[model samples]
Target: MTASLELPDRLAAYLQRSGVALAVSVCEGDAPLMFVNDAFTKLTGYTEDEVKGRNCRFLQGEGTSEEQRQPLHDFVHGLGEDSGRFPILNYRKDGSEFLNYVFMSRIRDSSDAVRYIIASQFDMTNAMQRSKIRQNDETLRTVLSDVEQMGREYGLAMMSSAQQLADSVAMMARLSLRDTR
Candidate 1:
């Protein structure tokens, strides 16, 4: 749905109570957080009182890289459209880290003025870990295949050398017999 349409109170409440994790921030000045749903708290481990009126950057920590923070920074400064699904390493209130996939969009009023920014965060730590495991497995398989190929080549070379040695020994024996005769 387009952000221009004002969400009714009931609809907003429904969103707050919905199963999805989301947070709404007023974009007037510092983009202070205005609302956070129950799911948001459950995901971040921070209560509404702790997060209200604060910038959501509190979720970022040492684990968050500058590259991941740049996109969100550019989006907030009106340098980009929507901040697409970007994965950010974020820390919870208890300092536990998780890969967060964040989607942010601007909500505008009828006059076309920006009113708020709605950000939805999804936990993707498990998916990212699985992807890494698959990549490692592929790398291991490639290494094993190369080693097996080298082994086969070495075996062929050794067999050829043994055949040449046997032929030389047989020729030497025949020459000795001819000399004795």
Candidate 2:
């Protein structure tokens, strides 16, 4: 993307201050990064100076699944018109892992030729982990309920057995008393 086709001053300032991470790359070969907002730098742990000429794929690491990469590849190749959104395993500069929700779209010139690719990345690691924790909590609750039910059943069975034993003792006492009389 040409630096001349700049975002409006007000809008650029707004994006730079946005809480969401945003990045822009040229649409040409390799799609080298052209701009990255402060949030992007914070999220990826890379300054714009370090990433300006590199493709964003540097964020991907060994844990990044191939399934997630395919859709991104297709989107960048113009195979799909809709913006692509996918969760990818990404590693920060410190080798820490995070779940990144990547959303990518193409920007076009007035003549409809693609000019740039703008991508936004949102960290969803906490949200995903919370969801898993909720599921585990539900499972634990179900297991506890089952255990409680079993305990109740066992208690009832024990009570019934004790009552039967008491009745038998009473019958034997009456029989002995009759025999003595």
Candidate 3:
């Protein structure tokens, strides 16, 4: 795809001001670099002229797995005709791999044909690692709490109706006592 129209000043300014990096491509058989912001240039270590008219696949390396490539292929080939997410693990020109969550969309004209593809990328490697650690901690805490609750109610009939379960643990203890009596 080729963009016959120019990027609006407002949208261009917005992309520039946005802290995160972004790159836009116009799919011409293969995805071609149309525009990239300064942040994107800084992140990828590629100059604007060096990337213009080049395919973004240059970022892929041996470390890049098929799991990442397949989804990207599906998005660009199928949903790229519409608008889809192109999240993938991509490498920078510097050979540094990063988790890039990219959302790809098409720019249309009066004829409703794809004119351009705008891909916004978010570097999520750090945030995703942090989230995994937090999730593990949360899971451990939940498991420990469940274990403790089981210890306190050992060999007891913990199962109950929804109304009974909604009651406090103290009320449940009273019910248990009455049952034993």
User: Which model scores highest in TM-score?
Assistant: 2
Per-residue lDDT over 1-181 for candidate 1, one digit per residue giving the tens place of the 0 to 100 score: 2343334454356447545466777766778787788989999999999997888899999979999999887777666663345679999999999888776766554445665667767677775578865753464354334333433543422122212222222222222223333
lDDT of 3 by residue, 1-181 (tens): 3234445554456455544455666656687787778877887788988987887788778877888788677765646345555557778888899877665555544444555566656566775487865753464354334434543564444333212221222222233323333
Q: Write the per-residue lDDT of candidate 2 for residues 105-131, one digit (tens) a residue.
A: 676554556656777676777765778
Total residue pair clashes for candidate 3: 1
RMSD of 3: 19.5
Query: Pairing residues by index, what is the TM-score of model 2?
Result: 0.67
Which runs of model 3 end up more than 4 angstroms from their true locations?
Answer: 1-5, 78-81, 129-181
- Which of the two, 1 or 3, has more TM-score? 1
Q: Which stretches of candidate 2 lie over 4 Å from their true place?
A: 1-8, 129-181
- Candidates in descending lDDT order: 2, 1, 3
Ten residues in a row with the worst lDDT in model 3? Answer: 161-170
